[model samples]
Target chain A: MDAAAHDTHDAHDEPHLTPYSVYVGIWLALIALTGVTVLASVVDMKHQAIFVALFVATAKSTLVVLYFMHIAFENRVFWWFLLSAIATFVIFVLLTFADYAYR
Target chain B: MSSDTAMPDLPETNYINAEKGLKSWLTTIDHKRIALMYLIAIGGFFVVAMGLGFMMRLELLNPGEQFLDGAAYNRVLTLHGVIMIFLFIIPSIPAVFGNFCLPIMLGANDVSFPRLNLASWYFYIAGAIVALFSVAAGGVDTGWTFYVPYSANTDANVMLPMFAAFLLGWSSILTGLNFIVTTHRLRAPGMGWRQMPLFVWGIYATSWIAVLATPVIGITLVLVLIERYMGIGIFNATMGGDPILFQHLFWIYSHPAVYVMVLPAMAVVSEIVPVFSQKRIFGYRFIAMSSIAIAAIGSLVWAHHMFTSGMADEGRIIFSFLTFFVSVPSAVKVFNWLATMYKGSIKVDPPMLFAFAFIFLFSIGGFTGLLQGALSVDIHLHDTAFIVAHFHYTMFGGTGVMFFGAMYYWWPKMFGRMYNRTMAYVGFAMFFVGFNTLYFPLFIAGLKGMPRRYADYLPEYHSYHALSTVGSWIMVTGILILFANLIWAIKRGKRAERNPWGGATLEWAVASPPATHQFDGPPEVGEPYDYKIPHLGDDESAGSGADEGKA
Candidate 1:
């Protein structure tokens, strides 16, 4: 297979934006998200805080996955995988709450 | 006209020249070579651990401290778990098949990180050496789980082996990352997500779990080491830290860890099921998605393992429900496999035979796990032999059986040689019979109120323990026969055809022991298990599914 076939289908290869812009944007976003996570940790939201911090982290991770990892423009499998992973995390949280609350 | 019809008369693959000595094996980054390394390493550790197992069994032969005292027994048992779980099962699938087939299946020349791939082998060896050092250094008596307080206080060789394990986890994480990136960035043209083979899906799912969950263990282990070496109070109950918190952090990584061990095996089954059935996998999208689902959900249910470890009552209930939720995707995969087999011309090759065994054994393992999932049931059976039996059935019976089966299934394409099928069949029978003999009696021993991790037992449990010990010998003998068969085949086996089993995946489309660059051109993107196409060389007709086998 022509290795060049990959460049044509890459999501970021569109003419509207240069590759430089994409890279810069992704780096900035990652930095901002890391800052947010650190800031959220310092504030004492008590029991509600862990979820808050995780939510922000998850959002940042999504950006990284979508752009940096290139899953956003890739096949439906990546999206399904990310969604499934998040859904499982939700289920875990819900179950933990149920166990702690009921018993 | 086929653009890539002529087979390249490549140099003899390392496989055909199996006796080129250490240099050929070391310099080679072929997946098969790496797989052999894994086979040797895991086999060596299995023997050492099995010896420890026999000593434990011998001590319980007639009960009451016959062979070794409690302290020695505990230390040896801890060493046994450390070796078997970390050294054997955790790396079983990913190292073996993922090393051998991942790049080839994707039609890439090699893994995206080939040097790191070889590095993982070195790290594995290093880890094993460190593990041996720990064993020789008075041995760690803390269970493999290493529940805090005691782990921190114990004078056993905790730091070395635990550090080795931490490095092993890092190696696993890197491999997972490699596979994820490779699968995403490296597939041949036309091998879209829907068209990608299931083994890739299994690895893809497992990679995600490894990347996300492994680091938590890294952090947790650091905390343990800190408490042990630096006298920090992270998990020290006497120092005002909760010991159960360690369990919390531990299972967070450990529980999902079982999936890291098993998902690739599931992937192996997915590949095997469709091939032998002579049918396209039923619900290809669902099966693929379910693997990812299982990976994600599997990680979340780790808390369930800590239920009897003195978590809050509410925590136990929550963990139980999450455990049930996690089972959904696994059940989905099982149902799809059954559906794939329905009304199909299912051939019972050795690999298919093992797939059938995986379904039966894993199902037993899965169902028995539910008993522990229930809050009341676990309280009674938490530390019993029932839990031990259940764990083995899932891991040993589930992944272990599938691992052997996968080796048999992919042996030809990976090694370019076929094993003696009759010997293969005999090996399977011995393993199957011996496995039951070994573990089923443990189930009996478990139900009779026999607790785990103990070297000696009451006289009443003596006969059963003796039976179990004898059965273990049978199991060991079966494994020995398997290795012997594989070794003989490597030396004197018949040359394999490219599509020896009539398998339809891209890996089968290449020459046996494919060239340094795995494929000459883009692989034919097609129905993964299709075998009846008019011209198998034509990529366009490959995925059309029109000529799929008729039942």
Candidate 2:
């Protein structure tokens, strides 16, 4: 197989080409999520507002990765790798925080 | 020009002869050529850094400074650390050998992005140049770590070196990106993950660490630069910034950066041991997985470096535990390597000797590392000569020795010439003896409470310091001889066979000093370490494949 065919095979067993409308929809969803984050910030959610804002931001980025980046259609290995990267980052942050908090 | 007409016989040109002139090399996108460029550049830096180390050892020969004063000694120490860490060890195995061999090992024509590979080399040179400029314009003495307020307030050319470090980090990240993509996409047909060479697996693990961890240091250095010029208080203690934060950020990358240096060395050992032992690698999957394990667990153990840096008790305890845990994967590798060598047809070639030495020296390094991992022990050993000795044992004995062994192993393949075996053996013996002599005493001195990075020491420490200095001279002599043998071999030695070591790998299938394009067609993937199925260079008896392959 050529490069394109090989890529399709590795990415999705059967290539699934999403419609242009789906991309547009994902873009709109990301925008909506951003707006939600902004709204959460403006409202007096107090300490929970930070969590809400983070949730919306995470949701927005997920939408971007899954749909816009075509990771949704990509192989499962990609998701595992992404998760590992995030986990490693979170571990670093948490460990650093552990030092700072106790100190 | 008829369709059936045989193509005209082109000149038989490998990458070295594929083009002519300095311009060809400068603009060349060929991974092999770029690897050669890096070998030369990185080799030069190694020599300079080695000289700096030699001078430091000379300075330490007596109780007081032999040549350099305190201030001068600090500058030399800083430059040596910076150059060795950034220019020599970090990029030595991966950028040089990885670029040269990864593509060929994968049976691909070149890396996924050839232009990007070339760009990374340029970035490396640019970084080196900036660093050298820093040296010329009054060197920075904040050390390679560039910790906190000293880095911020220093009158030395700190900004340039920091910028240089930033560029080097980018170079590292880009190389990682290119290798990761190449590994994922460019494997030969029928070569699955298991079929991939252990070296590729090693590079794969190292690349991920480089990609994820390097950016932290890049940003940290930028923060330092910002604080220096703009008076930003990111890590400045007086200005409410915590200095420990800098240690956290630096070691986050720099600790994993240890694997980035040594994993490829381990990968080289993984390749050499099986080939020379005349057996398939024992526990191939375990060895492969351990590389990944090292990368992952290695990243989490960065705080171990900050054990004595005033981190909280909880932090020290957690970090010490994690640090001890990281050693498990490394021990797994060491045991597996020993098993691979057990009762096998071990050829005591230069490469195998180095591999054996790596196991020994790296074990010493690892055990000492474990000693330092204990919170209480680390408080005693931290900032001492013992830590210095331990790091050298790990970095120099592990990666640096392996780097030379790789040069010996791949010299024939890379340059198509065989080096003098007598000289190689002599050099290896001297190097091994000199290495132990140089560092072992430092370990003892360190435990005796001799602090490191000092221009002078007390009368009681003089004997150990003298012995260490003598060992440094012997080690340098061995290094010189090794380089001389290889350099002479490149031009004057006997011609080399394609499969000099008689192992099974895709690179060995191709010509020694391979053709510009490594493979004419997709390579036939086989068990990478299948020694029972005799390789091309083996005799007919070995070729008969009567012996059952040992796993």
Candidate 3:
């Protein structure tokens, strides 16, 4: 394949570049989520704090994957592959926890 | 067709002759060169580890110490396991063939990240140096798995090996990432995902497992290093940390790692069986999807290794059930291979002989795996020679045999030369016979209650040990003959034709050794395993000619 042709192919399908303001907004949202995680850790509602911290961290990372990593603009297959990897990791953690929970 | 007419004259300039000087190879980003570099490194490690294994077997020839004391034996065993698993088998297929063939098979010029591919090789070398350094500094006694508490408590230089493994894990992750991206982005303009060669699909699946599971082990090893150096309470039982947690984490990567080892071999079999059998691959989609299925399902079955490691009954049952289901995908592959060969005009070349051996030996390995999948039976078989036998059968017999098979199948193309056919067969016979002789007795010895990893055995198990020791000698002799044949053939072997096996894959469409830029232009994409297409005749350059003219 021609080098120019490959570059053109990539450029043709490229998503409209996300505006800098939107990236800044996503960055600010991540910071806010981190603050919430810190707040939850400090003011622990016992076991609920763990859940709150996890939720905020997940939200923060999801935001990073979407806008920061540009995964939001990737093809559907890319999304599925990422989802499957995350699902496999979650299953490993859950299955191990199964033993710990019963014990 | 006469053999003289069938073999085409060698290309005037191929990848090997495209450049000159040692620095060119060191700096070249060509995947083929990198693959050769990997072949040298991986082959070197295999020989070293094989010697260590043979020595260990020699020690077990008697009831007591022969040459190595218990400490020396432990270190040798540890190095053998560590080098074989991390250095040799894990990178064997993907690093060598995958780097060389994947992009060409995809009809592309190179991997998506060429420099990163080079860096992965450097990471491998760096990690290998650290591992060798650890050995020189009074080798670690912890087994390859580096099970916790023992690893943390070992006064030997465990930290270097752990860090070494961590670095090697990064190399694995980078290689996986490179392949994943190259497959997604760099395929020829017309080649669809479904149209890819099954070997590419196999690597694609294995890469995902590499990207996902390797990082867990990398982090686990880092934690182990920290625990040892700083006396952290992670996997140390007395420090209120759970040692079982270490097993869970280590196996989380190591178990799926077995699939990492075998899937590419299976992929090679998938490619070789169809070409040599003169038929289309039976159930191509099924075989491709099964690779993915094995990767996904294989990850879940890691805890099967921990059945007797004080895992809860419920966990054991769940893992056992998952383990049984994991076999389904493997069986699908086996059945498809047999079906592909059922009615076809099969050529029993060296590669095919090894493939057939792979099926037979891998079947035994798989069935024995099922035996251990049974929670009740596994408890009895756990930590015994049976487990050791099962692992070698699947690994050495399955992946190891197929690795040699792939070497035979691709040897001509990689080096533009042919090995002595009679010597090839002689070597194969010795390897197949010696491999069985070496491992099969271990199965019997395990059933007779011989524990593995022991420096000594009881008198009742002495016969089995003696037989196994002799078998190791035979096996090593076979391996030596095989290597010697290939080495001698490199200089003296006949020049090979472009498509010697009449393979339909894109790699065969190029020059025997391939060009530095594999394709002059975009390669013509077609069904990868269609044997009905005439070999090295009319359509050989349908895509190449047009692309060359345009270029």
Candidate 4:
């Protein structure tokens, strides 16, 4: 039962060159985002600053997850696994807000 | 060819069976051996905790100046809760059955990282030793929750045990990570997600929660310890730290922690229900999804625990409704388990008996939980035995009963031996009867205004307290018998076939006490659970060979 025997149709074998520049650009963008987040947190923006900081953090994490973790290039099955975690986070944070909002 | 005759001869017993001794147990790295060690360690701790419970009951038995000081009783009760929650119940099902079964169920030789698995056991043991030191040194009376200013302010030796708990949580997170990675990467080639047995799903869900939420508790405990020792500015309010922040952080992990405790029990029930009923689960997808839903919803409901802890009125209202919402998924599971049994061929094995008990007891627990979620009701039942009784019914009756059932249910598969069925039934009866007697009265006493964690209670609650103590003894007796039965079965019982319960899961397709490499060949990837699938008896289908390498 050689598993590779069943892998004649490999998904990663698609013709696509994700270039070195793509990685360099992503790193630069991430560094810029972190600077913005830190600057935003310092301004007396109050609760708005907190949300901005979280949003920026989320963006940075997304970039890391997609490129560094290679989740973006992974299979649909892997996406399903990753999305489940995202969905759980959404539910946790939103449902909490639902309480906060209603109250 | 004469090659067969020239083949190297090996010893009769290799590393696994050679020279059985205490040394073999302590230093050995075999997952089964490590799991057995965990079983013994946690079992001993369970006894110690229950003994503490007995002492509490005795003090309550006579009410005033019965056996120990007010502080001593408080300390013992706190230690009992902490030990049972952290040391015993949380790890009981997962570490024991999960370690033993995960590889077998995946049709793999071992966990993806067996050394990590072994390291977890060592971490567990070290944590246990520290916990015992805390207990011996007059114990910390902060309750298992270790609520804010009190925990930080307590002079009783606190930092060491809090550190122990913090380390234990990391150990739990590592174990969770190990399981998640193994279950994902190590399944046999043809084993798909849908093809996985429900117990695996249960563990997978539990692992996810363990990985994500345990960090919060780990940090919380660290903060608490730092506050206690170095006078840190985290949870302590005098240093501009909000005590409410402590409650928030604690429940963030503690609430999800209940799911960690209960999901595996639910998973065990899912596996047992189908086998005992001789039916495929009514809706496998629903059951599996509900586990994920419960884990997700469970994390958000932590605020409900703090409804009366002086959060804003808005926070209270929001948490109250979210609490009810979390109950929806839990109720879905309860209904699904019951529906799985409807019109199916139900067997009355001890495992099923306990699953039935879980359904009843967890329902009581869940409903009582909803009662507490009501801000009005919680204001009254805040520190009462009702809350204590509610959790016991859930954690003890729900998780503990399911754990025992799972042990009996999977014992044959685990040890390749059959336990004495009559003894199993007797143990189940005593446990169920004694369990209801013990906790049900607490619910009554609680509602009638008996606060929990008290060394002395009003005279009116005296008779019920005595009855409860008697009930605890009966429950303890049942556990002793249950332990004996399993031990005897392991050494002396009749050998088991591959699928004693006729389960269609991948685990049952392998050998009883599966070989080092689990599958004879590739997993027979058929329907995971389909009552309609035709079955051949074990004897006729037992000729699969091991040499054919799996992909």
lDDT of 2 by residue, B398-450 (tens): 99999998999998778767888899999999999999999999999999999
Q: Is candidate 1 or candidate 2 better by DockQ?
A: 2
DockQ of each: 0.31, 0.62, 0.59, 0.24
Candidate maximizing DockQ = 2
By DockQ: ranked, best first: 2, 3, 1, 4
Worst 10 residues of 3 chain B by lDDT: B542-551
Return the clash pairs for model 3, or none: none
* Per-residue lDDT over B132-233 for candidate 1, one digit per residue giving the tens place of the 0 to 100 score: 888778888998888878888877768887887888887788788789889988987877888788999999989888887787788888899988888878
Quality of model 2 by C-alpha lDDT: 0.88
TM-score of 3: 0.94
* lDDT of residue B97 for candidate 1: 85
Best by TM-score: 3
> Residue B139's C-alpha lDDT in candidate 2?
90
Return the TM-score for each candidate structure. 0.83, 0.90, 0.94, 0.86
Local lDDT at B492 for model 2: 80
Write one digit per residue (lDDT tens) for candidate 4, span B47-81.
Answer: 89988887887777776888799888778888898
lDDT of 3 by residue, B123-226 (tens): 99999999999988999999898998888887898889988999999999999999999999998877898899999999999999999999889989888888
Q: Candidate 2, B546: how far from true, in Å? A: 30
